[model samples]
Target: MTGDEGPSYTVDDALVALGFGKFQILVLVYAGVGWVSEAMEMMLLSFVGPAVQALWNLSPHEESFITSAVFAGMLIGAYSWGVVSDRHGRRKGFLITATVTSIAGFLSAFAPNYILLIALRSVVGIGLGGGPVLSSWFLEFVPAPNRGTWMVIFSAFWTLGTIFEASLAWIVMPNLGWRWLLALSSLPTSFLLLFYKLTPESPRYLCLKGKTADAIEVLEKIARVNGRELPSGNLVSDHEIELQQIDNPSEDARLLSPRTNEIKHPLGMDSNLGGISSLSVLLSPKLARSTVLLWAVFFGNAFSYYGLVLLTTELNGHSKCVSHKLQTEKSQDVSYKSVFIASFAEIPGLLLSAVAVDKLGRKLSMSTMFFICCIFLLPLVFHLSEGLTTGLLFLARICITATFTIVYIYAPEMYPTSVRTTGVGIASSVGRIGGMICPLVAVGLVHGCHQTAAVLLFEIIVLLSGICVMFLPIETMGQELRDSVQV
Candidate 1:
């Protein structure tokens, strides 16, 4: 009577039949809106840090605190929300993050003191920390063959978000002030709230949790939206699909094997495990090694990527004495322009990733980009001319952006649906440690007359990250998502 008692069809079957259509398009738009909102919140720090420094007459150390506070909150949110999504449902996390980010970010603009502003920004970060879940949520809907490309494309919204924020800062900071920039940055997230009601919980998550009727209902809605019909069967879990494959014997079975180096399920995890138990799965024998390498790569990527973004303001502003226009321009104008131009470098990087992830494979694509990033940073060790320095930073930004996007696309594919969000969340939390440390080296150390040391530090860390990526256990180029940990 509940529509749950019947023979079942695999969720992947229904997804493939659904293909890409209006349902997915709406998912992309709403998810991209969330991506854009998080990017604006992150980029807000670089702009806000300087404005507040001048306004409050704070030192570099105090200014760095403004930037670090957000990362600290993100570190907590990433792991906590990851557990929450995996245990409760992905949809719950989406609604809560969007609501929290919008409210806190908008209120930060009205802070009476620097302390209050930092507190509000931290709360905003707690919400922004859930950003990685958007990728996990989006990927569940994509067909396997196109997942890499679509995920990379999904990440492109991040580039759009950064550029949009930079442009807004360039225009608003001069005329209105940082408060207006803060207030305006919070507006895009409102879009997520508007359209969220129309969105469904990830069907993959639903099926794995044994909510077959709910899963079928969601798929039925998707089928209707895409102008197609379901494949005429009940909804089933991934484990059931694997057992049926064992009896049937096909390419699907081969892909499910460990020998194929396809999707490696996190060993010894249960469907009911939540929070700390979910995290422990990452340390199981099968996933333990990959988890460590992923954490290192995440840390290095965050440190280098965020450090370079923050460095744009410092590096370009440092050149004011050398360039004719720079010498006459307002500090804010030069800062925003440098951030704007630097952000555009991410476009080609994202384009290359979209193509390379499917062609060259995840490991090679990520390793290549990381090495290239290190190469671009090597020139900055010694002070160069304004034009050359800006050019070098642009190229470096391209590679780092690509690596960051590819890594996010790659990580979720490594784990099963049961803990995919948790695995990514833990890795991202580790990455937040790097983000928190970036301001110190990028601004604090660089400002303290150790620019060469700062540059060299990033160069070494990035090179090691390239090596680390090559050791990831499996390549998830076109693999179907694993639903559970099975022998």
Candidate 2:
């Protein structure tokens, strides 16, 4: 079996044969670091806003800009990096994102003025934008049966990051200040670059792009690391698989025929299909409905998730049971404590989703979480005791965090390898739009005496998000990763 010949086994077949082991752990650790880095940077926005406001005596609008700038850059980064990973390679995208995030974030600590600080943080956001690619990259290596649980488990690192940021803010911001916090927070991301050499491009991506030999090389490496061997056959190219699909469109085609003269793209189009971008492929008739619904889910999830995060401080501020000394103390201390405490809710949320994601499936797990999250959030619209309000916020955080992780898993699984990152990146970018607007509502309106209206808006959005999840055409739980739209 020469490299040019159609392999007797598929990528999935080889992965199943290898099973999950040490190599998969390595991939998870590497990918998880990216998650941690991105989370810290994002969580930084919540902590830094107030400190900067106190230092510069900036208006509320300016403090809000700090958060919006990052999301704006994220919107741009998510779209661009997705396309980059789809076209160039996932490994390259990972390297670039880590490099950009680490350097830009570190420089943010030394900004001479507020304008420079925002500009630097925006650049950091650009690097942080490729976060969805990590999900796609990690998922491709995992077997279908284990994909949901593993992905949710991987998302736990993100929660760890948020907690770490809160802790770091609590320690540093109260003493060393925001500059020190920024410096310390940005430091961890730089380590990802040092560890980048440990990761390889997605073998599934290599196969779809017709790099069969390179794909095989990666698979073989994985097998070696896992103390196993590839399935006892030549690995199949996506082109060969597509030919079998064409020959018998309704069933799994396993014929190992030689390559044909007519080359084909996975979207059931000719290889020479012109002027079609990955975005266009996603919006094609075959995938358009799923794409739109998934986008809506993404938007709602972001609006509610980030809105609740920003609202934590507001909720804490309204509590009447605070001691007189605490009221007179630095607001940053109280804010960080509330954020730190609320973030713990994500642990149980992640644990629950990890279980439900596999048992109940992705669509059901996500919709259920969104609805439950809405239930917890609704009570906050009315005045309540501080302890009751705190309890409600914690419960709400749990559900929203779970939904956030599940949505990331579901979006990538829905797309073909050719545009997996692109689909995820675009969806994530739409979510950032929600993240951008959330400050205006979560912080702005809440502070402007429209707290009731703001919480009600979040409730409605969360409820609608659940409906969109139900409308999704396919459930990805245990579904084999699709290499092309044709499959």
Candidate 3:
């Protein structure tokens, strides 16, 4: 009995000796910082869109191209980073991404010509390509039960960053100009790197790499943070560890192995898959239907969401006139203040999403939100009055934001851990293609028939997305992650 007790104490003591409580908080903080970096990258472009147009004398089409270029880079980056993270380690990929993105963001601000701006914006996308990898890394560390809630919280930071950018643009763009605003956005990335430096690598990543000792060390740190101690009997043996070690092999030798070869050329598919190999995996007969449906859902939603946002300044000229008239009695800050308030509306939606996602179930919540969004859009298209259109836009924004949040959470969970980030990255990249196309489409429609036509196109996209959402397999909620996929 004494010996048994001793072993238990040894395990517990080892964990206690590690001091994990403080460490886990630090990890969460690091994750939060990463979220902020992503947020800043996303929001900065939206806030500065008007300013860039003014400075560069850009037509709406050129502005769309600049924005689309960033998304294109992101699409490529997401796939690249996913593979890198799976091959290397999450922390390494994250650090490199932060460094490059921060540098690119600052450089983009200083871009002197349209070509240079496009190139730099693409670089910024490449830097942001690390987002899905970081998201996966954080998800793997947290307990399954708490995963949804934590992910929601992480996403909320995105909204917070949006608000921050909107506020900054309102204040700084007028005084310091848009370039300074772009430069200022890079500041958070530096803090993110510092936070990453202090945080431990993912325990799951360590386990995957056959580093059992290191994995245990990280777990002990987590246990300590949670104010719990590990039991000696519960301790895992090296033999019990499932991960395989590379055994210090040469790179060529490593690539020649069956496992590595399979990863390189999966499912006896094409030999020259190029960067599209990961995407090809999603197109398999088993996954093709889901893949196509998801693509449609994402495309439709992104087209509508981004189209609406991009056309915000154009919608309901009468309403803008009214707003302008009302603001005649208000300060110069009135428009800025209204933008700030609309930005904040995303906060509550995010918070509610974080709290309700797991409980409400992904498919149901998402579909319901989409349906509500469709209802809101109907009013916008038919009512056509300035005040009614503006009110409907607000309602639609909240609904669409919540639905998109569900898609982000649900999309990644649909794939296996092996290709989780890859799948999500490709999905997101596809959505960026839509993001690129939507604005152009809006511009064409608006040019032909004014804002009403643009609004109608958006409504069609939303309705299509909603219908696609209904067809998706509603099987992810409450299922164990490993067990989530049907195949």
Candidate 4:
């Protein structure tokens, strides 16, 4: 028997029994670096675009392209990295993909022309694709009881990262220039790589890959790191054995679920799917309905959130205080300071999500945020006092941003471990399409004097998204995970 036919249960049981531990905390801390790095770069454009535009004398269309270029590359990266990490290992994605992204982010600082900057930012985006899975990797290792809470807390880093970028830009952008800001954006890559260097691959991943011995070894490390001893018994899992079956190599040699661990042709002949599709599993009778709804939720979440958040640079201009920052003899960094305050709204939103997710269940809490986000956006369809309008914007930011963490933490919980990342990747790519759409459409509309239409559209789409959440069939709140489950 090959590793596939070895002991059915190995590391998962040990991890579950170990409970929540410090090792999981360590993973969250490391994963936050990638979150910060990518968050900084994604938001970097709002700061950099003005500088690039001033430098190159770019038109509105040209400036929009700069943002689109990154999402275009992100579309490919998010999907591919998820699949690759599932096929190879999450550690490789953290190391190889993030390093490549950091370098691209850093190199954009030196681009000679707008064309080169766009190309470099695209490269930065492709690398950024691998960054989101840091949450999935963390969730896979942590105990199930508190997984939702931790993942929500983890998303706070996205908020913190944005705060860092804004605060740093406020300090340095006036003197050091946008080039320096871009350079600093890439710095987290090296730190993220170093952090993962001391980390182990997910033990659940090792078992699925049939690396029973390796999986156990990692669990021993987890137990030790968590300040506990491995239970004195077979680490093999009874639950996994009940959930998994040996597939006939000739009939279905590859796993089509994003979990992709269903069957292994470790020697390579039957390893990759030849005829089946990973997405096909998500569309199966058992999952098809939920998958469609899930996609809608993901699409709506991404569309409404990024669509609005990205336009902050332009939107902030309409505020009296922000307008003063731009028009007055105020400190040059005042604009940056305003940006920091707007993005800082995400902090309290995440904290609220962390507690609400457990207290209200993922469904109620997430859907509520989605609808609440819509309510906040409604007043923006018409004129209001500048302060009120900005406050409304910040309020919307809190709701949509909270929705992001909630959906992200919830999606993987719905899937078996085998396909969790794949599910997330696909959903995220769909979301990126939203991210791609909003900037192209909304930015131009804001420029063309159709700001009301833009606000209405964002509100309508998100309202539908919240409705989708209400229809979701599964609720993972306070649920234990399934490390493996049969077809």
Candidate 5:
């Protein structure tokens, strides 16, 4: 700890100047594990879907119910946990989600019936729903200069999850069966709780809660770990300054006036200029339009992304569809191999987005990739050869996965710290509506309706999503995150 004799700086200045170091690296490891686990639960249904169908002698509709259950939980979890973290603290939210998800995941494997399985999956989904919080939590600690790149790269961890799921299915789908696969997929989540102990609560979060002394202590720990000295004197933060300014304005002066529609407080209680409430802040004038558009992007992204992911094996062959043991096993083998290969596409996709987001700006990166995804999906619309269709589907997956990464990167950058997690949670919860609908549409449009309808829907949705990206007004390339939502 160096002497507290240097320049008097706000916490933001101290943090930005310290730059990226051990703290960022630790976040990747700690949060990265959570990311991988969340990815696994999201992908688990896709991997286990076919197996569940065969074991329980079920219809595609029931299969969809199981897949969507987790997303339903996630929708609720994202909203509830976002509020928990904002009002209580980030650390509490983090630990609670990890613990609940882990226990639910492990126990879900033992469910005896299809109804029980989906029910348990819903619990797992709720825990997974809190996943967006990890990104916002980690983002506050990172420097803005490389923040977009780091976010894209962080999303790349999803590839490892894809690898884990496909590889697990390849090995166990034959001998161990779907029950064992579910068990194996969830077993690793216990490690996330252990990792939780290693992460410090976000200093920004502490500052927001008015625990200034605790916030400074965490910052010093981060500085020490980074081999840097703290800039001295009473370390201040923008939040503290805002509180002071709002809490103590001059007599007969209302510097932080409420908007036209807001209620005026007697005895000066409007100091909570957090704009009505946490959720209301995003709906405030400066942020409302961006919030709606961003939610549109999230909805389109999940609708297509998970629609493809949860049905990858099913779309490939009748292995999980047919009842003949020998044929079902053989077809499943082929589907698993194909899923493994296509998953490799995600690695390159993440790398491309990591570089593209930095070079192309967010809107262009998302728009270009989404357009390409629609182009690739056109082959499926034409009902091409299996060989040609499979190849195109992989290409489409790469593009959509890349687009997904950019959306996550773009959302956090769009909202400020005051409502970062809230904005993300609301957007994600809306996206999960698409996720919930994905299974029903993916299966119904194919088996119940026609494959052509499903392909056209996917193509149309991806194209529309790309168009939405192009319409966004701002492009957060290397902009710093502020304490207030500034549109």
Candidate 6:
């Protein structure tokens, strides 16, 4: 819009008129690159785990610590980057996180010993933790109607990165070893820095910063990218910009106030309540129930997803035995190939969920997928024949992968903007705890007792989480991001 006199247009018309073909595609591509970088950093640890164990002669407990440490860093990084993004802008925050991640990943490649490796992994976690926050920045720029699809499309890059990592492991591990894989993972981060030059700062963020002209310029760039002409309407005004910048009073007061009743609910006279009022807010009556529900959802999803993925490496090892058996009949490395193909199942799941999320609604889509996952996993627990189990596991993985995507989208949508990143970060941090624990749990399940029992427990958790999800405020579908929860 040119000035204050231009006619108002809906977000959809503005997006379409701007040229949805090339410009939006380019923006998505740019965002996708950063996503791939973040995903690579997040997942490379899984592929490298066995190699690290072998090279370092690490005990099972020590090996678990190494992986968990990175997630610990992620917990720190996610909140830190959110604060930074709020203070600075999304562009600078993205650039800074990308740079830090690249450095940390490269440093991890050269870690001299197991202790150093674990430390570096934690550092890498801090750098990579900014990914979700940056994704939020991207969402802020787009209109709400198109936001779900865009976020879904953006999420596909995560699977693409995982696919890339698996492919690289398939090709490079046999020849170059895992160190090379670790070193190579940092390469995508370099490319993202280059792509970022063409990407503009979030227009909404600019508006919040009182930069009306700059915000307008960013919006024009978005229109140009989408291939639409600028409307001859009044630019967003300073007053409107100021109003947009106003932080939600409820959230702000909660963060800043000294009142104990507002901050937390006392458990009982006998309970050991002390100086941790902020942490206690999580247990308050108004927020406590939702918090526990979200935690269960996150914990269950993480435990199930990571447990299965960690098992993939074991399956890959089993594939070698299958390959050996098939080798008598043929000559291909069929086991490795099977593992690679199975890892790729995530791609289609991500793409399909990306396209279907808004149309289906987050809760329905997520719960349906979780139910499908439970169905798929049941055969595995019965100890079906290897071939059948393998196929079922692949199918189960795809469904769970889609469910994971929905959770990421739903988690942020459920919270208000003031506590949006904080809430998601806390959930993510808790999920990381589950991730850290799942591997050890898997070890016990597969080695100590029965794999079926371990997997069954995971399925039960997923089912419970899905049930909990149904009780959530289901009215979030198609709703605008709010400044406060409407209890």
Best candidate, lDDT: 1
Backbone clash count, each prediction separately: 2, 3, 2, 4, 1, 11
TM-score, cand. 1 vs. native: 0.93
Q: TM-score for every candidate vs. truth?
A: 0.93, 0.92, 0.80, 0.88, 0.89, 0.80
lDDT by residue for model 5 (235-273), tens: 665544444445555443353423212222211112243
Runs with alpha carbons beyond 4 Å of true place in candidate 3: 1-24, 231-281, 284-286, 316-335, 382-387, 442-444, 447-449, 483-487
| Alpha-carbon local distance difference test for all models | 0.85, 0.83, 0.65, 0.74, 0.77, 0.66
Rank by TM-score, descending? 1, 2, 5, 4, 3, 6
- Residue range 395-463, candidate 6, lDDT tens digits: 877887888888887777665443445556667777777777787766545534366777788789878
Higher-ranked by lDDT: 1 or 5: 1
Clashes of 1: 2
Candidate 1 clashing pairs? 8-234, 9-234
Worst 10 residues of 1 by lDDT: 320-329
Q: Please list the residue runs of candidate 2 whose C-alpha ends up more than 4 Å from where it truly belongs after superposition.
A: 1-7, 248-265, 268-276, 318-330
Candidates in order: C-alpha RMSD to true structure: 3.8, 3.8, 7.9, 5.7, 4.9, 7.7
lDDT of 3 at 434: 83
Point out where model 4 deviates above 4 Å.
Answer: 1-12, 237-240, 243-276, 318-334
Candidate 1, after superposition: displacement of residue 94 in Å? 1.2
Candidate 6 residue 54 C-alpha distance from true site, Å:
2.1
Among residues 3 or more apart in sequence or in different chains, the pairs in candidate 4 whose N, CA or C atoms overlap within 3 Å are: 9-236, 9-237, 259-418, 259-419
